[model samples]
Target: MSKALSKAKGFKQSKSGTYLSMATTAYGVFGVAKQVKKARREHDTLRLLDAAVSAAAIVTGLALLVRELKRLGDDDVLLG
Candidate 1:
């Protein structure tokens, strides 16, 4: 019973961590989108900068997410 409870708690924590990370990534993407719109309304150089920054953020976020997912998979295998 205690073991089951502990496992549940750990699972909840892991899920929460993943959810928070995803939320952060989503916010970063939204920020980039806003900047792109603003740049379009204003300067060409700033627009390019925004595009570059957005691309970098997306790539980094995807890499981080993939790494985390792989780690989680390995952890599950170990636990099982």
Candidate 2:
């Protein structure tokens, strides 16, 4: 692979990358809350369910990000 391609692929493996992922996921969860509130206001059942699902997925992403960060800290795993 080219240098640029390698860098792109490995970017998210770095510690800073993991922090960014966590921050983004947290932001997504906040957005989902906003959607949920809007859905409630509009009495939109489908939108409510959609927001619930999005919230779950974002939480899962946050979990994975935390696990990665823990591994990096505990095992001294190589990052990028």
Candidate 3:
């Protein structure tokens, strides 16, 4: 059980898994955009601000994921 859990944990850091995460995170941008439109339509300042914050967070997350992917690609080979 512990080994299986470890494998699952490791997969999250793998290239393919990182790509999948980035894809899912990218999808959140569309949802945030929809929220922004709705907020504008309803003239809700708070909701619009919330949506803006979410969009910023999503962008930051994608940037971090891209950096991790690049690092993983570069350090793929194990010297030891």
Best by lDDT: 3
Per-residue C-alpha lDDT of model 1 across residues 1-80, encoded as one tens digit per residue: 67777666575336445556777777777777777777777877768696777869787886887677657754552254
Q: For model 3, what is the alpha-carbon lDDT of residue 17?
A: 80
Per-candidate local distance difference test: 0.68, 0.83, 0.86
Steric collisions counted per model? 0, 0, 0
User: What's each prediction's TM-score?
Assistant: 0.59, 0.75, 0.80
| Model 3 Cα RMSD, 1 decimal | 3.3
Q: Candidate 3: worst 10 consecutive residues by lDDT?
A: 71-80
lDDT agreement of model 2 with the native: 0.83
lDDT of 2 by residue, 14-72 (tens): 67778988998898877898999999999999999999999889889999999998877
Give candidate 2 regions above 4 Å deviation: 1-9, 74-80
Off by more than 4 A, model 1: 1-15, 74-80
Tell me the spans in candidate 3 whose CA falls farther than 4 Å from its real position.
1-7, 74-80
**Can you give the lDDT of residue 22 in candidate 3?**
98
